[model samples]
Target: MQVRALARGVRMSPQKARLVVDAIRGRAAVEALAFLDTSPKAASEVVAKILRSALANAANNFSLNTDGMVVVTATADKGPTLPRRFRPRARGQAGVIEKKTTHITVVVSNDIEPTRRGYKRKPA
Candidate 1:
């Protein structure tokens, strides 16, 4: 069975969060947690928390065996942008500042086998 957890309006940009999420995709839940623990990226902390929540959901809500769970899908999608703010610019001008947000979703499953897809190289 598959279990999923979502965190919306995260204060980080989707691009930044995607880097961390992509690394943990198709990895074992426990291993992904370990990777997040030592990761230096700021987004890792938030992703880790969401991963833990997914694991908990699997174990508690679905009564699944989390020991064999794999991270089936992990994604960070763009969220609603907050109101634009103006920052003082040169010559009394104002610069528009956009506050971006992200929505993160993590899915874990105990029955699916994880596979790693390698990058394809083109001939020179």
Candidate 2:
């Protein structure tokens, strides 16, 4: 079973968010949360919240074992830029500033064995 959570319009660049997400990919829920808690990057906190949400979703919706779940995929994408204007140096001159935004997604899934079909085992 799998569950996903998203954090949209986060006030961080997608590139920075991607770095944090990469660190936690394939890590178990508890370990990932721990790592995020101590991480020095600002983006870590945002990603951690989304991860926690995903864990809660799994537990509440799927009733899955939290300990057995790992971060299957985590990604960050660029969101709409917020435009701002500012005056710098010369009079009557204006500069445009673009505040970046990011959309982060985290997926948590439990380990499950794949089933094989059309085969029967013989009794010993």
lDDT of 2 by residue, 1-124 (tens): 6799998899998999999888888777788899999999999999999999999999888888788777877899999999876646577777778899999999887763211221122233
TM-score of each: 0.87, 0.82
Cα lDDT tens digits, model 1, 1-124, are 7899999999999999999999999888888899999999999999999999999998888778889888888999999998688999999999889999999999988777655641222234
Task: Report lDDT (CA) for all predictions.
Answer: 0.88, 0.82
Q: Scored by Cα lDDT, where does model 1 land?
A: 0.88
lDDT of 2: 0.82
Q: How many residue-pair clashes does candidate 1 contain?
A: 0
